[model samples]
Target: MRNNIAEMEFLYSQESIATQFSRDKFHQFLQEDMIFPLKGVRKKYSKNEIIIPEGEVTNEIYFIESGNVAATKDGENVINFYAENEIIGLTNLLLDSHSEYAFQVISNELFVTKYDKESIIEKVINTQEGYFYHYVHMQNQVSQMIEKEQLLRLPSEQRISLALLILGTKFGEETNDQDLIGFPKSISKGMIGQYTNLNPNTITNVLQKLQEEEIIYPARRAFYVDIFKLEIKLDQVLKK
Candidate 1:
């Protein structure tokens, strides 16, 4: 299937080329190539829309604007996500190949941007300026990778807490009722397992214990952490 740029937006843009090259002569070069990808922007997809299959030869790239999309090796195993302000299909663009993971929408409001390889290689990468542009862009990726590695090294429980805490930190705010309220999101046992070494049954038990004592709220695939109580508990756990 063919895809265009408007269909995606950056889900995890550690650094945007636009913002990064704003003051340089590189803006025009990047702009021309960007226009080449969006020759046709398709309507957005609802959740579960299969944007790209795991192993297909495609020249398209996407950028997520809103919502979230997760990539997986099998349909069942999630690899990563394109949340907001990040590029999708980047692996393919850089490697001149296809994805080994399946991408599906996880949020209802996701939007994206798409582009082609020829434009990228020619208009964006062939020139001296193009070389510099890709250099700065790739450097940020190294940093993002390191951050993810540091995160993955933490225990599963900590990883879950960290993801939630990060999500909460940006979207969450303190309440006078002694709770931090942010995006009303959910966490599931299986997801916790993927992020850490926890098993489903153990995840269930820990979640239940937390919920029973009002430490968290586990609802099916969605779970909530009580900030005030959680912080106190985390403090004690960290000390140990």
Candidate 2:
């Protein structure tokens, strides 16, 4: 049981890196392909704009050119986040179901290439590379959901630590210190609470403990993490 738990946690922690690589390759294909430019329309969204409302029928696919968007449950709980080079709406498009969450632009400005569902099916999905991208995308999405569910089942401290580590790996920028990584200010403590389904007070307390331990520290515009220290601390927590 101990070995199983440890192995599961290791795979969950590594999912972000795997997802990043898949997203990059998928985006690269879209960028190089001529079908996208011919069949898709480019659009820009301002911050806080709703791209898709909850329960709405998804009719189009969106490819992010720049900026980020968040998928929220009932306009509050952030279920997921999509950044530049990521594609949204494919799941809903393929499933032919209503959107489970509201997607909103989180960056100051978001640029995306939008493709109607039919166009995507007939133009992109029919192609060999496109089908492969879709398969990999769906696989990554499933892995993320499974990992997130497992992380949420952990104790608050471990949950928060692993959540930050995943987010840091996906969206963070490397700092001068090879061991440190910096996540954008958009990944606030409140966002962390929402993502983990934890109370605000609990999030605050756990974050404070992490700070005191020097595993993570806050900057004016970002959260800086000592990746090595954080992994060690998380391993200790898991053993306990």
All candidates: TM-score: 0.65, 0.83
* lDDT for each residue of candidate 2 in 22-129, tens digit (9 for 90 to 100): 666665655565665344689999988999999988888888988878889976798988888788888754645788889998778999988777656664455655
Global lDDT for candidate 2?
0.78
All models: lDDT?
Answer: 0.57, 0.78
Residue 29's lDDT within candidate 2 is: 59
Tell me, by TM-score, which candidate is best.
2
Query: How much is the lDDT of residue 49 in candidate 2?
Result: 96
**Tens digits of lDDT, candidate 1, 74-117:** 66665555565566665434544767777887665567656665
